[model samples]
Target: MQKPLTDFPTGSVVRIAGIDGGRQARSRMLAMGMTPGCPVTVLAGGPTGCRVRVRGSEVVLCCGLAGKIMAVADDSDEGPRCNCCPGPRARAI
Candidate 1:
């Protein structure tokens, strides 16, 4: 079984897998450099918004927006990874 975006912890480097909403949603994600295959690091998350680090930029996305984005945990232990490394494997939400 594959891991879902919600499986990642507050700070984990992940790769964008899929977007689960409409065109507008997809477009918004794309605008944030969240297109499939892009890497994103979870900064912080709550009921309100999730702070994500993408392409060296930090952005906050609401829960609704975050729910639309699908991501996979990046298991590669490549150096320092991202500023938001939530440690080992995280369970799904």
Candidate 2:
């Protein structure tokens, strides 16, 4: 089922469904690799914003930006397993 980005729980892997915002916002998101169909995993969330793991990169997104991203929880077992390497740490805001 589809849901807002803010509703997604931390650590939940999801696929970008669509964006809901004006052209400028969409363009910015696109530049950041948040285009529709992209896979993203919610890492943390809080008052300021949320952090998401996308394509092995950890990106911190503000609530406004996060709100524009629409995604569906990925319940598939066919994707590659994550290799949680020791690198940048992620914490709930």
Candidate 3:
């Protein structure tokens, strides 16, 4: 089963399952390279907000916005690679 974005703690690597939001919100997130199947790293988070690295870019999302992003925690040893921005090696910190 997938978990909400907020459920992942800092330093967790996860794969996006889907986003639950209106057209505008979805479009904005998609435009920022937050598409399904991409790997993201949770950098830091509070009760209602968090910062994540997506496709080598930092994105800040509030709890309301984050709850809309569903992801499955990924612990594979394979290096992280976002389809949107491939080539760079990603190692868990």
Best by lDDT: 3
Worst 10 residues of 3 by lDDT: 84-93
Q: What is the Å distance of residue 61 in model 3 from its true position?
A: 0.6
User: Model 2, which residues run further than 4 Å from truth?
Assistant: 46-48, 76-93
The regions of model 3 sitting more than 4 angstroms off are: 76-93
TM-score of 2: 0.75
TM-score of each: 0.71, 0.75, 0.78
Model 1 C-alpha lDDT per residue in residues 1-93, reported as the tens digit of each score: 234455567977777777888999889888876666567778886556688888778888877888777776666433123333354542212
Q: Regarding TM-score, does 1 or 3 come out ahead?
A: 3
- Superposed Cα RMSD, model 2: 6.8
Better of 1 and 3 by lDDT: 3
After superposition, which runs of candidate 1 have C-alpha atoms over 4 Å from their true positions? 1-7, 76-93
Cα lDDT tens digits, model 2, 1-93, are: 666788888888777778889999899988876766667888896546789877667899898988888777565433222233232322122
**Cα lDDT listed for each candidate:** 0.67, 0.71, 0.76
TM-score of candidate 1 to 2 decimals: 0.71
Instruction: Tell how far residue 30 is off in model 3, in angstroms.
Output: 0.2
Residue 12 local lDDT, model 3 = 86
- Model 3 agreement with the true structure over 1-93: per-residue lDDT tens digits: 687889889988887778888998789878988787678889996569779998778999989888888777655433233555434443322
